[model samples]
Target: MSVRGFVPGVLATAAATACAYAVAALVPALNPTSVAVLLGALVTNVGLNRPFLRLGTQLAARHFLRVAVVLLGLQLSVPQLLHLGGLGLAVVVVTVGLTFTGTRLLGRWFGVPPARSLLIATGFSICGASAVAAMEPVADGDEQDTSTAIALVTLCGSLAIVALPLLRQPLGLDAASFGSWVGASVHDIGQTVATADRVPGALTAAVVVKLTRVILLAPMVAGVALVRRHRSPDTARARIRPPVPLFVAGFLLAVAIASLNAVSPATLSVAKDVQGTLLVAALFALGTGIHLPTLLRTGGRSLALALTSWVLIAGVAYAGVRLAGL
Candidate 1:
């Protein structure tokens, strides 16, 4: 597409992203990405999205999302995962792997399509909306499937911010243990921090554990790409697409740079801000593709899968944490 074709949609998305940030600031519990999706959906459902905006919005949702995913690597560090200790690391792995595989199985049983199932599993098991965005291309999912998965994960993550804290005492977990639980179970980084922040001294462990899960994103995405390539009927198309997407490689490179401790704290902070802004804009674009009526008609099984996946992850993480004695 021409640069001129992208201008309108990009501008529209940018304006919506800024509005989302403002709204999130006003409502601390609501994540900016979630608000962005809602804003995009509202615009589309209300007929505010014009033809001129279509190309640009599509660009934001696809290319811009990849850029944001690459930048997300700056937030991770190998040392941080190491700090989680062997048992804590094991907890993260078990939680993510089982939740991902279990969700896919549940989706199949529920008669959900493979693409939607993969997207939902990625969102729930990895890092919520961002993970969904990263996996969409590899999963070969349509916009509706992508939006549905995002909505499901975002809704569940928001609920975790409220529900997990209330369960801490009942689960007999102290602040740190609760933090570990929140990290292992919560879908998004912001939601994990929000949940753990309810208890003093929980934020640190929560952030570390969450990053460890984030670190798995690259491998998981690569694995999916390889599997998709292997199963394709068209060998020519399979050969044309790399087994690992370029953006995934960029993400790994960013992680390596961060791990080397070469980037200044100020630089990393600025990159984080940039990443968040891009993600907000990208999600808004994707949200524009959502038609609420259609989603409502087709989403029942997906919703059941999401809820079951949520419970499964939380239960598995809890068991792993207890067994590991984290």
Candidate 2:
């Protein structure tokens, strides 16, 4: 039986999601990514407070997030990623590579226990909030590590929302390029939107590229799960096999649906909206999975490594985008 009972996060996710939609309708100027992340975590936390509730809410939450991720993809096309062409592909490679490099080196440097570094690294570098959600079950990350990663991504993305506008002004870049850079760099979809809003005329490109990165996250998480297994000594004796992360599969299937020519734009848009709502809820559930004291047990080294990974991603985003002329 799950001991932790969810209350606050669920309350937070529902209220926040409502707030996101209301502002979108009334003020017509709000972006919902980070808020969704927060609310998702909150709502799911409450769902998990009881076994029956957790089971139902958890499944529903995942289904929603997956659809959201796919719907978000409808904003892009194969050609755009191809347009950035080889250089565009490089952006993803570098972002992912740097993230992994930082995680491994820092993890070792800080003595960050074992699995924590890998999980946080994937979350921060590849897809942000979604990546962490996908990686948790596969990597078997303890509840606390997952929570810490969520908190870190959310905090960083929030800071970007405020800082990105000023950044665009100083950079002296045009819309498409800026969008590409932001898409290539930011941690989550909301940050991409928030960053786009601040930059002027950057939404379409940024959101699309960000979706490109999001689609790539599943493979990275799956790989991490395998590596973790290879390194585990007990695999030989205990015959443990890693569990396939269901959300990752769902995320892929959603992508397939989005890629189909048969799906109408209106239908895709609806799917995205609904999924965005649910993904946020799933995150709420993942947040519910978090236990405060358990997170604190991370070997002191892990925190330092995680911090370094985040710092590197943020810094690289700015410089890499500029260098790429995005």
Candidate 3:
């Protein structure tokens, strides 16, 4: 918390994020947030850690990511919300709930620890690393588990960037259906945009559906916090905080303002840019905390959960699209 401790972590995060942006510029297909995470991991694994940067990196990963997620709400508006309507919203709710439940059960079957598995389930089923970061305190999970869940989400999301496009043609999906599938299934907004942008008519549907899933993030986090509190012993009950997180409140406010169309287009664009930048920096901070050896110890089980979840979501999304007649 001291200046000396904080400055180093900020500098490390900033540097890693800078490198991630550069990489993204060169390889536009790669998600900048995921690239930042990988770069952060690379820096740490390669022994580039400075002692002073530790606390700052932790702050960046925890606090900064929440801020970014709030900014993310600016990208949504009433029009996009209406596009999905009742059916689209229902599909998002169903898919997210099923994926979350399935992943947790699968994680148990794989013998992964409860907290870590919960984090993984939230991360994979919801908004990827941001969701994982948000759920960390609520779940009272280990940093190692947070990093591992993020890494697995990143890995699977990255794979989808490549694999989804290939399957697009083979699966004979039209533009709208393909977009809906990607929006429903992909972990992060950046990854969703990148995947659906490949096909015409897909981008709009993808963004709409993806943001619908994002809208559910608040309740999901609140539900987790509530569960954790109820499950805690009566002696410790007094220590439990409110179920709704502050940043999630900010997220809802942003969405409400955005829906009102109060913000100018130029201002919204700037917020979007800021959101992306903050997320990259946060992911880099998170990456620096990772230990490859520790991650690998549970990697197989985590990977299995991720792969199974990926398949499940993809299939579910496809079914949703077909059922909706999109």
RMSD of each predicted structure: 1.3, 4.8, 1.6
lDDT of 1 by residue, 249-278 (tens): 899999999999989999999999898889
lDDT of 3 by residue, 146-234 (tens): 88888888888988989998998888889988998899999998999988988878998888899888878888988878776777747
List ranges where model 2 is wrong by over 4 Å: 1-33, 36-77, 229-244, 289-307
TM-score of each: 0.97, 0.77, 0.95
Model 3 residue 206 lDDT score: 88
Give the Å shift of residue 145 in candidate 2: 1.7
Instruction: Write down the lDDT of every candidate, Cα atoms only.
Output: 0.91, 0.64, 0.85
Off by over 4 Å in 3: 233-238
TM match of model 1 to true structure: 0.97
TM-score of the candidate numbered 3?
Answer: 0.95
- Candidate 3 all-Cα RMSD: 1.6
Q: Select the stronger candidate by lDDT from 1 and 2.
A: 1
Better of 2 and 3 by TM-score: 3
